[model samples]
Target chain A: MTIEHSILGVIASRPCTGYDIKTEFEHEGAGMVWGVSFGSVYPKLKSMEEQGLIQNYRTETKGRMKKMYELTPKGWEALHKWLGELPSYPSIKDELLLKLSMWDRGRPEDRQTLIYHMKNRKEQSQELLDYYLQWPQNGHSSISEFGMLGIQYVQERLETELRWIEKAILQLEGEPQPPVQDPYDLIPKQQERRNLAINPPVITVHPESSTDEDRV
Target chain B: MTIEHSILGVIASRPCTGYDIKTEFEHEGAGMVWGVSFGSVYPKLKSMEEQGLIQNYRTETKGRMKKMYELTPKGWEALHKWLGELPSYPSIKDELLLKLSMWDRGRPEDRQTLIYHMKNRKEQSQELLDYYLQWPQNGHSSISEFGMLGIQYVQERLETELRWIEKAILQLEGEPQPPVQDPYDLIPKQQERRNLAINPPVITVHPESSTDEDRV
Candidate 1:
């Protein structure tokens, strides 16, 4: 549905053929700002025409026959309604957090893995930040006013993400305790060996072992 | 695959029955921190057992025979590999951003919608922020040290999102101009009528009308 509305916006901006619509979404202001993909365009164009939201006509240019699409009155009304629709909560599925939740805190190697992923994610966000700074100035026209608003928001988000990564790294590096029962004891053979041993390092290494909350 | 690893993590935390695994995912620290769900757990458990990643034993607890699952040597090896795997870039598909990029800049109604959606998103992020600040204190135990790192990251993200909303609103309210070609002209009858008019409001309404970039 957003794809249709974006197409309508491009058409509303100018009467363009299907190929022209693809180019705009692939190369123009909306493409970079909205993350609109071109894969869904043709099928959506067909359905939108069938639904009477848009209409197209055949035109010949440069020895090619092109179907140029534009919004019908119905399309304009739909685009207007879509532009006003309330947005929903953005779904969050951060893999780093997901993996970190199950982490083996006693393992030094696991801590290193945690830092590796944080840096990887930060690098990717940094690349996006770099692109945002250097785009539009390259060749194509500047993004529209509303598009600028979206870009600016993304810019802040990536910056906050980078800053948060730094703070989290410092916290992890400074931390010194593993907070749960070591899963190694869940193995029966290991559990039996530990139980048979006289005073063990579980008591030796765990200075906070007397706390009730750490037991479960 | 992530589901499998998370289940492995839970089993590694403690040797637990299938039902226990479900409960932990539904009501424990891992659920909140990782967004793990129970829907796919049973099937993944079945496949994991077949693949030598886990083993289960029948236990009679309070007259109910339950299948308790535990990690194999192979399972521990898999969990280690997963925790070390370099994380990929998080997928971002923000609906508000996708819509904002296609906005009808000439319509006051459209501007209101943009502000409305921005505020709506901010309010939701604020609710998450309130939760981040208030949670764990309400419950069984404070999140593990690493879990604290993930929560702190989310806390900062939501705050940045809220602040970005304010800045975007200011930019939108302070500025004007419908950039690119207005889709209105694509309507043939409207285009013809607009062309026929001696002096039009496109000239009157568009103050940045003379800027070459504004012409699209």
Candidate 2:
């Protein structure tokens, strides 16, 4: 539904062919916030046109007939309504965190696998942060100051996440204790595997030792 | 697909009813990472059962029969495969950032609404952080040390976001300039709002205006 509103917003700004809207989403500043794949965009445009929120006309360019879409008054009203509403908190489906929750159940080799993936994530974050820092000056002349600020917000988030991952690696290696201390010392300490954060540690602990804990 | 894998992982740990799986998602540590609504869970369970990844048995309870599900060996193999694969970075669809991107297009009243919402978000973050801090000790005795680590990770993220939003509010109010400096002084200055941050009163004359050049 938000995607529909976003498409309406784009159409309200300017009448364009569906291809133009796709390109705008893929290449324009809007892409930075929400991405609409061509797979979803065409169907959305067709449905919206059928719903009377948008209207289309054919234009001939270089002897090619292209269907251009624009927002009707209804579309304008909808876009305005959406723009005025308070946004909901984004729902996150973080798989890494899910894996982390089950880390204790995994074998030592599985923990090594997890650490390897965390390193990959860290590298990706570094690359994204570097790219964002060097952006706006790199041919993105049309990105407004506000858009740049939004990008900076994302960069800051990435940096924070990278720091958290670094700490998570340390936790996985058993170097840093859990961030919150257990006052009762109920958490049983396991035999530490040799620094998996730096190198693949050997599995010395018996697998049966892990099964002693009751499953949630 | 990730949800299916998550369900598999949960079943692999223990044979339980679909209701148990739903509860594990809603009330357990996994809830902090990924959420699976009851609506999606039952269907996924049925599909996975058809795929032979999981099998279910009926157990007579005090008065009624309860369906319990457990992972097949095939399901165990699939879980291991998923655990080994490099996890993809979580995709965020932050509507607040989207709205911020178009901040200039909004009316003054809309800007106020946005600011109000940011404050609300800050309050929510603070509350969540406080809750995370007090968790595990608050009758969450079954939470493993690894689970506590995940909670701490989420807490740190929320704190970082709160800080970012504070800075964002200041930025939106036109008190602080963009984090990056303008190299060529090409950015046009708007009327300074108020000195929300310290070290103010440096209202230098515009370079082009001082040079008696044409203002675009």
Q: Give the whole-model CA lDDT for all candidates, comma-separated.
A: 0.65, 0.66
lDDT of 2 by residue, A23-48 (tens): 77654543245567889999999999
Residue by residue across B30-143, what tens digits does model 2's lDDT show? 225556778999999999999988889999889889999866657766776777788776656667777665544333234567787788778876876787777766863445
Q: Isolated chain A: TM-score per model?
A: 0.65, 0.69
For model 2, report DockQ.
0.17
- Residue-level lDDT tens digits of model 1 in A115-137: 87888888888987877666535
How far is B198's C-alpha from truth in model 2 (Å)?
Answer: 41
DockQ of each: 0.24, 0.17
Alpha-carbon deviation at B113 in model 1, angstroms: 2.9
CAPRI band of model 1? acceptable
Indicate which candidate wins on TM-score. Answer: 2
Model 1 misplaced stretches (Cα beyond 4 Å)? A1-41, A56-69, A105-108, A136-139, A170-216, B1-72, B105-108, B139-142, B170-216
Record all residue pairs in model 2 with backbone atoms less than 3 Å apart, i.e. clashing: none
